[model samples]
Target: MENLIIYPENQKQLQILKSLLEEMKIKFKSEEQVEELQDWQKEKILKGIKDIKEGKFSSNDDVSQKARECIK
Candidate 1:
């Protein structure tokens, strides 16, 4: 079996898609119905956010320079 993903623009479109899928008897899961994030994933995301708030990240130029140096 193959899986398909769909992104409806607005609530109306989403409702229409859900209705159509129900009419066709096709099973589908919406984003809100998905499982919760794992603890490690959540921790990493929170750490990244904290680092950003603390201004601990490097600039794009610094990253590019490092990349160029590594490529040498």
Candidate 2:
């Protein structure tokens, strides 16, 4: 069986689509799609959050200053 995805903006539209499908005797399944993150991606995000909490990141001004020094 092939799966088709439908994106309805509101409840009214969803109900209408459901009614249409039912009237036509077409079988359909509605489900929420979830995106799973890779282990490395989760680890990187956690590390970034931890670094922020620990005040371990440089400020934009510091970065700009370093760039200017390098360009000189």
Candidate 3:
């Protein structure tokens, strides 16, 4: 069986989803119950945040220009 992930925007939506899944007898796990991020994932996220703070990332216009050049 394929797996699916759902993000409920609010507590009401989360409750509704939980209730619906229970009623349907479909097994599912909440975000809190899921495994934590791997070490590499955490490191990559931290590096990205550091890069943003250091202004090491490209701007939207720069990225778009590069994409257009690539497509030419």
Candidate 4:
């Protein structure tokens, strides 16, 4: 059998999915549930988001050579 990954952003959507799956009698195993963010990761992601929001970003090549796609 193959595996299917289902990701729902919030509790409402997750509850909806649970109801539907229960109604259909589907078998599923939820290993780990997504939870609230940690301070460090949240800060990092927020910084990145703010950078995009404030138009603060680097060109691809500024960070890595591989990102500099070339054609000849």
- Return the TM-score for each candidate structure: 0.55, 0.49, 0.57, 0.40
User: Which tens-of-lDDT digit does each residue in 3-64 have in candidate 3?
Assistant: 98898899999999999999999998886798999999999999999999999999999999
Q: Which 10-residue window of candidate 4 scores lowest in summed lDDT?
A: 63-72
Model 2 lDDT vs. the true structure?
A: 0.92
Positional deviation of residue 45's Cα in model 4 after best superposition, in angstroms: 36
Q: Per-residue lDDT of 17-49 in model 4, one digit per residue for the tens?
A: 989999999977675654678999999999999
RMSD to the hidden true structure, all candidates: 7.6, 9.6, 8.3, 8.7
What 10-residue stretch in candidate 3 is worst by lDDT?
1-10
Cα TM-score of candidate 2: 0.49
19 Cα displacement, candidate 4 (Å) = 0.8
After TM-score superposition, the amount by which residue 60's alpha carbon in candidate 3 deviates from its true location, in angstroms, is: 1.6
> Which runs in model 4 stand beyond 4 Å of their true positions?
32-72
Candidate 4 Cα deviation (angstroms), residue 15:
0.5
Question: Considering every candidate listed, which one attains the maximal TM-score?
Answer: 3
lDDT of candidate 1 over 3-72, digit per residue (tens): 9888888999989999999999998888888999999999999999999999999999999999999999
Alpha-carbon local distance difference test for all models = 0.94, 0.92, 0.94, 0.83
